[model samples]
Every structure is written in structure tokens, then in C-alpha cells.
Target: MRNMKVFFFFLLFFSLCVEFSRGQKEITEVNVGVVTDVGTSYSDVAMLCINMSLADFYSSRPQFQTRLVVNIGDSRNDVLGAAAAALELIKIKKVKAILGPWTSMQAHFLIEIGQKSQVPIVSYSATSPFLTSLRSPYFFRATYEDSSQVNAIKAIIKLFGWREVVPVYIDNTFGEGIMPRLTDALQEINVRIPYRSVIALNATDHVISMELLKMMTNPTRVFIVHMYSTLASRFFIKAKEIGLMKPGYV
Candidate 1:
């Protein structure tokens, strides 16, 4: 996915470069924007990879007379922040294209700005199916939508013969994005969903433990975990700490 992101971004800037190169004598610099949650570990890694990819892309293709200059923006992991970042980049930095807004909710707002500004919005990680409904030619998703995985999930549930299943997901747009498709898939397999567990993005260990404890009272044992990796890891740890990972529980 990261490689695809780099490829898409390069494709945008490269196209611009091609146009800029024609009727130019000296090397031209093209400005592009990368907006994401700046302080997080994954964001740091993504930024590093983007920098490395840009360097490698140019090093081997030294004949090209166009260079892409990156402008980074911190979205602060908020929807409005992402929109603001894109607007600032478009107005102030005059970036030709935008790389990210991270979450689907953030992308939701950023897409509108892109529509008004006529700048392309490309995302590598925002996988909401809702984005496609907008029918905006400016928006591009590097990754597949959450609904794309529902068929596999349905097949697995059918194979396991799990009569009852519960979806454990985040409360935000990322979590809700896949629910409709997954729900339909589970219904097709005759899997009854008694409850939907919603975890907050900033949920604490104690909160996760309480949620697990609440689930223990229910009859359902099968849980479809759909959430961010970091929060899911913490949730599983808390689950194991409370004996939720033992036999008879899925």
C-alpha cells in the first residue's frame, strides 16, 4: 500500500513535471503536500518512507529535469484539521496535489476542499466505501475499501459455522465504514449479531476491560475485530488479561 501511495503521488507529480519540462531549460521544482497525523509513530514511518522513495525515484532517473518538493502538514488527527491543512496547502504552499488526511472522517472533509480548490486528493490508508459515493473525480484511494473484505469475512464465518457473531469496531468513521457490507455478509451466512462493541480511539485499558466484562454476560462467543492495529493490540491484551482469549471464545 505504501508503494502504491508513492506510485500514485509520483504519477501526479510526474505528469506535472512532464508538462513543466516542455518549454523549460533548467530543472523545475514541483510542490506537493503530504498531510497526516504528525506526532504518531506510523506517521513518522510513512514520512520516512516517502522521503526515501522520492530520493530513490530521482537517483535512478537523473535525466528528468523536474524535482518534487514536499510540504508536510499536521492534521492533528481531526476532521476539521485535515480540511484546514489541505486549504492552507492549496492557498499558501500552492501544492499541486495532496497525499493524505489519514482517517476516513478527515478525508470526508478534505474531499470537499479538494472539490472546491480543484486539487486532487489521493489517500493511501483511508478505506471508507462512503468516499466513492461522492462521485468526485478529484478523490483517489490507493487502498481498497473496507467493504472489499466482507466476502472473505462471510466465507470464514460460514466455514466456522459460527451461528452468532459480534462486530467489535471503533466508534469513528473508520469503524462504521465497513458495517453495512459486513452486516449484509453476515446476514447471508445466517450469523446472528446480538451486539456491536464500539471502542473509542482514545479508550483506556480499564475501559476495554469493562467492555469485555460486559460481553462475557452475553451468549455470543464469536467476535469480528475491526479496528486500528494499535487499539486492537491493546484491546486483545486486556481481553487476555480477563480470560476472554480462552477456549470456547472466538
Candidate 2:
């Protein structure tokens, strides 16, 4: 993950405290907080990556005396839970920085908390334009911004010579984050966005079918899908089952 590189670079900044670390012992413990939805596939994989990256970082730089002590907190996939976790990490754990909380929504509240506590909030996957718009110096994005994908989408649409396209996205902050930029990019290329397919995160099989049926009624077959998180996989499965993933559509 890109975050691993960012974390590795972050170690250089931690080197500023090397003297403080050396004063204490040969190996200094640098506490870093990781907040995320604990049981999710992404979270589990990311945790493993973080551990592996740290191991590699230490093995490569044995001469360095500072070591990151990762302290994890479960956000339980809720906004309030994320805030609580961040607060606990800052107030009790005394973590110098925090890693994640998964989504843009969770990061929204945590960013303010990080600002108040002077802790750096780094996210690798929260891609909402709204997050960057906040202009919080304490907040760092390890991944591309949501609007950055508009250029690629525009290029694809132009190459296909599609006049009209629909945006099929999850109904959430992360999914909606790219719409304005995507619409503007399409408009610049003289493309019409006939409709937006706002699929609910918890949409069932019937709900997905109803949405697909609605799209079928419309003439626009080309689509730019930006569904968020795990919903994208389910949405594609339903679209394929409904025969919408054929050669006629995108």
C-alpha cells in the first residue's frame, strides 16, 4: 500500500526525536495509534501490511534507535465510535499520530479531533474531496483525492465516443465526493449525464434489480461507476446477473 511508503517516510520525521529516545534507552518506543473497523477485510489486510512494513523498516535500518509502537482501536464502522476511539488514543494512549478510521465520514470527525489535539491524522483510503477542502495541516492523505479520477474517467468516455453516461455510486460521502468533478469533466467533453444511480449501501438483491430495471428504462447504457467500499462488488454482481454487464454497457 502507498501508506507503507508514507509511513516509512514518516520515520525520518520521527528521527527528530532521536535524542529524546536515546536519552531514555537504546531503542525508543514511539506510540502510534491505528483506528479502523477491526473485522473488515481491508482493515485486517492493512494491519498485516503495517506490521510487515514496520518489520522491514526496522530490519533495513537497524542503526536507527526509534521504533513505532502501534496501538490499535476499533471504530466499529460508526462515526461516534471513530471519534471515541481517536479521543481515547489521544488522551489515554498519548499516541503521537493516528493512522485510519476507514471512510471519509469517520475521518471527518476525527480530523477535528486531531487538530484539537495536535495529532497528525493520516488516511490511506479516505478519498473525499471534502476532506482536502478542509485544509487541515494536521490531516495527511496517503492516497489520491477523489477528483483525481475524473481525468481517467473522462479519457475513457472520450475514447468510447459515449455521448451520455450515468454514474452508479453508493449513497454516501465517499461515493458522492467525486460527482461534481466528474460531471464537470464530462461536460467539458460535451457529454451528458442523463441520470445518477444512487445505490444504497445495504441494497438487497431486489433493490439492486429495481435500480437496474430503472436504468434499463433509460436510454443511457454507458456508466461511470463510483460505488464505495464493499458495495461495489455486490453492485457489479447484481449488474452482471441482470445482464447489464454485457458488451452494450460500461
Candidate 3:
């Protein structure tokens, strides 16, 4: 009887262990790649948001068998750097999806890579119309194309009764891609573009100031400025310094 009791106890323990092991699910890991220039505030905020979202998703769904893992790579705000980061993520990390290269210029090459590798490339802030996702099914744009805003700008011009306007934009893929749409939109409303000022992405304060001075000499008070936030901030600072922000200026 003692032997039988001991054997029953051992069998029960073994059964419970096997049942517990069966109940615990194996974690399925899905690796996601984040490629961005961490030096910029935009990328920094993106990283924070991505982390928060991942944390919230996992915390709210404890029963989820699949876990998403994020691997971040800095593109260093250049084409070559972006390619390198993407290559590392695709080859070394074997990420399922890649998020960002920030600008359309950077996305141009990365999109091609993603297509070849059959990985999705997601961009939240790249707004250049030239980088069309239609060309590459793997490319996804989270933000609206820059051309979409041209109609709103045209409406504003019509409401204000501005006869002519000047567009001051960064001289890059982002800025150039919107020009044709903007011109067409403005022309439809009989708005004339007296001049289009192109500011280089790496232009210095002095260069921006000079450009503003040239614009001030012109009679057009209503100016449309389009660029990344970092360059836009500098432009406004110089505008304020030169009294271009005074009354009667738009």
C-alpha cells in the first residue's frame, strides 16, 4: 500500500508538470527595423513613440503569442548611411519590416532594397510625391503627399485675395516634387508665382538671410514656406531678425 501511494504521488506530479508545460505557449519573435537619423528631433520623437506603442500593445495583450522586437539603426541623414543601415537590418538582423529613412531622398534607395528583399519599408514623415508607393508595393507612406496640401494653400491664397505669391522651399526631393502641383493649383485660381526661392538643405544662416533680403526687395508680401521643421525654424528666426515678420507681411 505504501509503494502504491508513493507511485500515485509521483504520477500526479509528473502529469501536473506536463500540463503546465503544455499550457505555457512558446513566444514567436517578430523583428522590426527602425532606420532613421537619430540626430534629428523628428527621429527622436519617432523612437519614443515606437517604444511606447510596443510597450502598450504587449502590456494590454498578455495572451498574444507573438512578440514584436525593434532594432534601431541611424541613417546619419545621408543616402549611403541609409543603405548601410538597411543592409545591416535586412542581412544581419533579418527584420520583417523596416520603418523610415526620414526624407524621400533617403527612401529612394531603401525602397529599391526593400523590394528586392521582399520586406516592407514604412515612412511616416516622407511626403515627397516623387516617391510613389504605387511603383513599389512594399513601400508605405504614413503621411500625405506634399502635393495634397497645394489645394489648401491655393484656397488660402484665394481667400486672402493675394494676387501673387512666392514659394520658399528647401532645394531637395521634398521641395522640388511639390512645385509642379503647387504651380498648377495656383494657376487654376489665377495666382501668379513671381519667384520660387530654393534653399539648400545644408544652407547656413547667412545664406538664408541673404535669400530673405532678396525676397524683401520684391513686392510680394504673401510667401509660402515649405521645408523640414529644422530648416523652417532657422528661416523664421532670420525673418524676424530682418523685420520681415512685421505687420503687412504674410
Candidate 4:
């Protein structure tokens, strides 16, 4: 009976020791959240869904050892959703950083929350010129800015010797932000904006077809500013269908 008791004691001690060792070796946990803007049905999930892709690209780097905690914000293309998601991540989840709310419209919500909470926000796809205007210290972007892209497009237009051009952009920050700059550049280049059209980011179908059809009449090179991927892809596909494919098509 005494021998059996000793064996039980030893077993308990061994289990405790194993548990303590595991506690010591536990990996550090890091929580990262993502909030996507609501545009198309897919917009709210696009950037958040792409986290694995981003992780794969950075897996070799040593800074990514901790597991990322991603949270989705369905900022239905509005500030409220972004703000709510950011608050949840910052206050509830205690995330170290955040990645998205992809559109500038959605980004504004995240940015506001991030500023108050002091959480770093890394935007992978937002290209709003207003973001640059804010010059917020915490705002960091991975995609090319609209100002630069607009300048390049202007140069391309000039280089191609295009006299007149048309503009087709989404109504949100991505589209609205580029319009003024593009217009200013056109004025500087001595070119005219013969036509202009705007579409909602959430528009699934070809809302700009009317403008496109009109532009096709004059055949002025079209400059399309699309921030949402679904819209961009669809626009390109439609442009091709309408026999409008060229080097500077959009």
C-alpha cells in the first residue's frame, strides 16, 4: 500500500513539472486586426481575407514570430463601421496593430480610432489623396498614392500625344481624390477633359457604361480611377468587351 501511494505522488509531481515547463516555453502571442471598407459585397472582406497572403510574403522575416489576430470591420463604406471595429480591436482585443479598412472612406474611421488609441494602422490598398493631405503620423500606406499615379498617368497621356481625355472614377476617396489632380494636370498639359463620369464603389454592374458609350463616340482616351478590386476588374473586363484595350486605357 505504501509503495502504491509513493507511485501516485511521483506521478503527480511529474505532471506538475511538465506543466510548469510548458508554461515557461509558451510562445508570445500578438494580436493584429483588419478592418475592411464596405464597397461591393466583397469589399468589407477583401483586405482582411488577404492577410494570409501578406503573412506568406513576410514569413521569412523575424518580426513576424507572433501569431496575428485579425478582426473584420464591416464598415459598410462608412465611418461608423470602421470606428466600431477599431475600438473593438484596440480596447477589447488589445491588438498591437491593424491592417485595413481598405478604401480611404473606410480608412478615415480606422484612422480616427487609431489616433485616439495610439494603435499603428497599416493601409495596404488605400490611395486617397486626402490621406496625404492629413499627414497623420500614424498613417502608413503600402500601396502607391494617387498623386504619384496621377502624375504618371498625365505624363503617359502627354507622351502618347493624346489631345483629349475622359475620366471615369469611383465616387469614394479613390475616385474623388484623383479627379481634381487629374483635371489640374490636364489643364497644365493643355489638354481638355472632354467627358467625366463617376460610379459608386458598391456598384456591381456597369454604371459607367453610359459615359463609356459616349466617350467611345469621340474615342478620347479614358482614364479610370478605381480603388476597389472588384470594380477595377469588372471595369477592365467591360472595357475589353467594348473593344477598349490599350496601354493607357485606365
Candidate 5:
């Protein structure tokens, strides 16, 4: 009976040690949050790329002690939805880093949440120059700011000798923030902006058609369109229906 008791005690000790070692090994897991509109084509592609890159990275560095665990949250393409997603990632998932909330409007709130949580928010698609003024250390942009593209747009206008242009953009932070720089760039080259047309991100097809028709009534044939690809696709579809893709349009 004495020998059997000792044997059971030793078995228990061995089991505890094994469990402790397994727990220690699992402590190397790092949780990362991906917040984006999964409904969009851009984010669908981005998620695939991220998964492939992570797989390739882990395969290439098999000896690495740390492992990354990805947790995805769909922002649903809205400000409140983005904030809720970020909050869930930070509070519930305890993610160390956040990658995206694709638009500037979404990024604005996520940056604040990241700052409060001391988590880094990395954005690859939010390109508003307005975001730069916030100067939050927790916010990191992997993509070019909208201001950076203004010069390229200006060059195009100059090349075509388009004296006047109309700016057609979505009514959101991403669209609003880019205009000041774009307007300044166009003014530098003596190009005039006759009017500005704003379309809501969630605008219906009928609304988009109306806006296109309003734009068509004007004499300015050249238009500078800046918005998310999803909305931009709708805008172009309506523009095509209105014959804006013809030779007269610059």
C-alpha cells in the first residue's frame, strides 16, 4: 500500500509538469485582429493574401518561437460597425495588433480605440491626409496618403490641357480629406474646379443616376473621381449608362 501511494503521487507530479510545460509553450501565441469590410472585393482579396503570407512565413521560419493567431472582424462598411469590431477585438480577443478598417472614417475611430488600448492599428488602405494630423503613435499607415496622389492627378490634368474639371467623390472622411490637397494641386496648374459632386457611400442606384445626370448638365467634361472601389464601381456603371464614357469626356 505504501509503494502504491508513492507511485500515484509521482504520476500526478509528472502529469502536472507536462501540463505546465505545454501551457508555457502556448504562451508564445500572439493574437492579431483584422478589421475590414469582408463584403467588398478588396478585403476578400486582402484576407486571402494575408492568409497566404502567414502560411508562407511560418513555413519559412519553422524554428521561430512565436506564432501569430489571426482573428477577423468584419467592419460592415460603417463607422459604428468599425468601432464595435475594434472594441470587440481589443476587449474580447485581446489582440496585440489590428490590421485595417479599410476607409478613413472607419480608421478614425479604430485609431482612437487602439490608442486607448495601447494596441497598434495598422492600415493598408485608409489614405486620407486628415488622418496624419491626428499624429497618434499607435496608428501606422502601410499605404500612401491621398496627398501623395494629388501630384499624379495634377500631372494628368496638365498633360491633357484640361482647363476645368469637376470633382466627384463619396461623402465621407476619405473623400473629404483628399479634396483640399487635390484642389490646391489643380490650382497650382491653373485648372479650375467648376463644381463638386458628393455621393453618399450607401447611395442607391437611382441616387447615383441622379447625381450623374446633374453632373452631365454641366459643361465640364473632365471629372476627378476618388472613392472606395465598391462605390467607384457603382459610380462608373451609372456614368456609363449616361454615356459619360464617350469621346467627349476627358
Candidate 6:
């Protein structure tokens, strides 16, 4: 009886040690990989917080040991440059995942490389709906695509009880890709586009503004500006100057 009692005590102690070791192992191992676009600063709110949030997900979740390898590229929104940057990170650094190439143009090239290399690339603000179905198994996005935003715009129009909607979309992929969907959704809501304009990203002068103002004439009261940050700011400022938008709207 004495020998049996000692054996049972030893077994219990061994089990406790094994459990403790397993728990310790669980607490220490985690990694994640990130890639930020050159258009954004490392300390910039959009780039830093967005990438950190993904890394934080694995760190907080018990399922992963999230060790991260982040690489910032100097593409300045160039597609080929972004692709090359991604290739170097994946091939040399062996990053398991990437989260960037912040523009549709950049993502366009990177997606092909990512598909070929078997690495996953997740984008935050790429906004082009066309990219949604392109090599989709590897590409993921946290935000709604341009199409979804267009749907949202349609819903907003309905909520505001606006009859005529004039869409002022940029001529880029981000804008063109979504305009059709927005138009369809608005049509379903019995809304019509009395006016529309597709302007390039860089046309800052009143050439486009005069055209937009003519479209904004008494018929269409509400205007939806579908432009990137820089262009949006420029358009808003010019629109305000031309009395198209009120100070509050600005």
C-alpha cells in the first residue's frame, strides 16, 4: 500500500509538470508579417494602425503565435514597383503574409505575383471591385469594395429621399469600377443621374469644375464625389469656391 501511494503521487507530479510546460510553450510563440505602401508614412495613422491591427489579431487570439516580418516599400503607388517590393519580401524575407500595396494599381500587379508565389496579400483601402474576383483566393480586404460603397451611396440617397443623383467620379479604376454598380442600385431605388462627370486624378483647374457646375445646375441638388483623398480635398475646395458647396459642406 505504501509503495502504491508513492507511485500515484509521482504520476500526479509528472502530469502537473507536463501541463505547466505546455502552458509555457503556448504563451511564448507568435509571429505575423506586414508590408506597408510608400504613399503612406510608417507613423501615419492609416498605415501603422492598420498593419498593427492585423498583427494584434493573432497576438490576441490563442490560435496563433504571430511572429511578424514587416517591410515598407518605396513604390509611391507604382504597380511594378509594388510588385517588385512584394517579391523581394516574400522571396528573401520569407514573410508568411503581406498587408499593403494600398492602391488598386499597386494591388493589380502584386496580386499576380502573390498568386504565383503562393503568398497571401490583404489590402485595406484598395477599393476597386474588379480586384475582388482577381486571384481571389489569396487577396483579402478589410474594407468594402468600391461597388459596396456605391451601394451604400444609393442607400444614402434613398435615406435622404433624393430623386436625382449626380455622381462625380474620378476617371481611375477605383471610380469607373464602382460607377456602374452605383447607377444600377440607384435605378432600383427609382433614382436617376441627371448629371455625371468622369474626370482624371490630376485636373485641378476650373475646366472640370465648370463642367461639374453646369451639371449641378438647379436640377441636381445632391452631388456624390467619388475621389481619393487628395483629389477629394481639391474638388471640395474648388466646389466651395464656385459656390457649388456651402461652407458647412466644405
C-alpha RMSD by candidate, in order: 1.7, 1.8, 13.1, 13.4, 12.5, 12.2
TM-scores for all candidates? 0.93, 0.93, 0.86, 0.67, 0.85, 0.73
The deviation in Å at residue 59 for candidate 5 is: 1.7
Scored by TM-score, the top model is 1
How much is 131 displaced in model 2, in angstroms? 0.6
Instruction: Put down candidate 1 lDDT per residue, 2-21, tens digits, no spaces.
Output: 55566766766787677858
* Model 3 lDDT tens row, 198-236: 999999999999999999999999999989888999999
Displacement of the residue 193 alpha carbon in candidate 3, Å? 0.8
lDDT, candidate 3, equals 0.82
lDDT of 3 at 217: 94
What is the alpha-carbon lDDT for the whole of candidate 2? Answer: 0.85
Candidate 5: pairs in clash: none
Candidate 6: which stretches are off by over 4 Å?
1-33, 39-43, 50-66, 216-218, 246-250
> What is the lDDT for 79 in model 5?
88
Model 5 vs. true fold: TM: 0.85
Q: Model 5: how large is the Cα RMSD against the reference?
A: 12.5
Clashing pairs in 2: none
Q: Name the runs in model 5 displaced over 4 angstroms.
A: 1-27
TM-score, model 1 to reference:
0.93
Which scores better on lDDT, 4 or 5?
Answer: 5
* Residue pair clashes in candidate 1: none
CA lDDT, candidate 3, residue 183: 92
CA lDDT of each prediction against the hidden true structure: 0.87, 0.85, 0.82, 0.66, 0.82, 0.65
